[model samples]
Target: MAKARILIVDDSPTEMYKLTAMLEKSGYEVLKAHDGAGGVALARQEKPDAVLMDIVMPGLNGFQATRQLSKDQETAGIPVIIVTTKDQETDKVWGTRQGARDYLTKPVDEDTLLKTLALVLRG
Candidate 1:
């Protein structure tokens, strides 16, 4: 079977690079977008296996993007995993409500990220 394709939506170049490197090393095909609108567009066009969303951004934000993806019939089947710096309980709850399969605080642990990805892919 082919490796999963993952879409990473983050405005920060550093965070994007880190996540891209990690996912690539773990054998996932990584697609990237700099902001929420771009991410939503890419996700709709590519229909990637999963999405790694970052919360804070200029316009649209991760929460709004995730909600859009989840609600859209074209991308609703794709799972979203929010990878943000926000470590609040409410954030986690809200992310799930927005249709995230899981939430992880950044800087993310490689092991946890891989494990979570694997589980999400399986389910």
Candidate 2:
């Protein structure tokens, strides 16, 4: 099978590096964006199999970016999973409402992350 292409959108360089390392080690192709607008652009251009999006960003923010990607015909099928510090139920609900396929909080556990990715990217 071809390696899954995942787009990770987060402002923290450290977090991006960590996640990239982990996913790459697991044999996945990873693309990254340091902010929401960049994330959206990459999503459209790259057509990644999945997106790991951060909620808090400079200009567009993950929720808005995810919404745009989900609504756009070119990128609407990409599965977006919100990964952020927002642990509130409302936040998860809102993220889902904005078109995130799944929600995860910060300090993400590797097992769960991989499991969610597997479930979402199975094709």
Candidate 3:
């Protein structure tokens, strides 16, 4: 079977690299974008199985991108997980409202990330 493809949309180079490495090690095909607009474009073009997004990007923020992706018929079925530094309850609620399937704080746990990815993919 083919491995799942995941797009990592984050402005932080370190975060992007870490996630890519981890996902690759765990047998997931990783795609990357440094900003939200690029992320959305990639989501449309690549149609990745899932998206791990960051909220504090330079333009079009993750929440906005997620809303667009979730609402657009072409990308609506792809699950989005907000992987961000925002840890407040309000932030999580806002992400969910924006159509994120799940949320993960910065310094994402390897186990949790894998588990969340599996859960969303299965759903």
Candidate 4:
């Protein structure tokens, strides 16, 4: 079977490394972007199976990026999972409103993240 392709967008190198390592360990092919603009571009170009997006960044925030991706015809079907430090009901609701398939808080637990990924990809 082909490994799932995941695009991770975050400015934090450490977080990117950690998530990349976790995804790779679980047999995924990873793509990366450091900001929201780049994330959108990568999503359009790669059409990854799923995207892991950060809420805050220099260029564009995750919400805006997710909105753009969800609206675009070419990338609309790609599932986005917001992974960020914002851990509030409002934030989660907003992320979902932006068309994210799932929302995960920072310091994300490995099992939960993986399970969410599997669920989104399966659907």
Query: TM per model?
Result: 0.98, 0.97, 0.99, 0.99
lDDT of candidate 2 at residue 41, scale 0 to 100: 96
Winner by lDDT: 4
RMSD for each of the candidates: 0.6, 0.8, 0.5, 0.5
Is 1 or 3 the stronger prediction by TM-score?
3
For model 2, the superposed segments whose C-alpha errors exceed 4 Å read none
**How good is model 4 by TM-score?**
0.99
Clashes of each: 0, 0, 0, 0
lDDT of 1 by residue, 1-123 (tens): 988999999999999999999999989999999999999999999999999999999999999999999999999999999999999999999999999999999999999999999899888
User: Model 4: runs farther than 4 Å from truth?
Assistant: none
Error of 2 at 82 (Å): 0.4
Worst 10 residues of 3 by lDDT: 57-66
Better of 3 and 4 by lDDT: 4
The global Cα lDDT (0 to 1) of model 1 is 0.96
* Model 1 segments more than 4 A misplaced: none
User: Best to worst by lDDT, what's the order?
Assistant: 4, 3, 1, 2
lDDT of 1 at 88: 97
lDDT: the better of candidates 1 and 2: 1
Worst 10 contiguous positions by lDDT, candidate 2 = 114-123
Name the runs in model 3 displaced over 4 angstroms: none
Residue 75 Cα positional deviation in candidate 2, in Å, after optimal superposition = 0.6
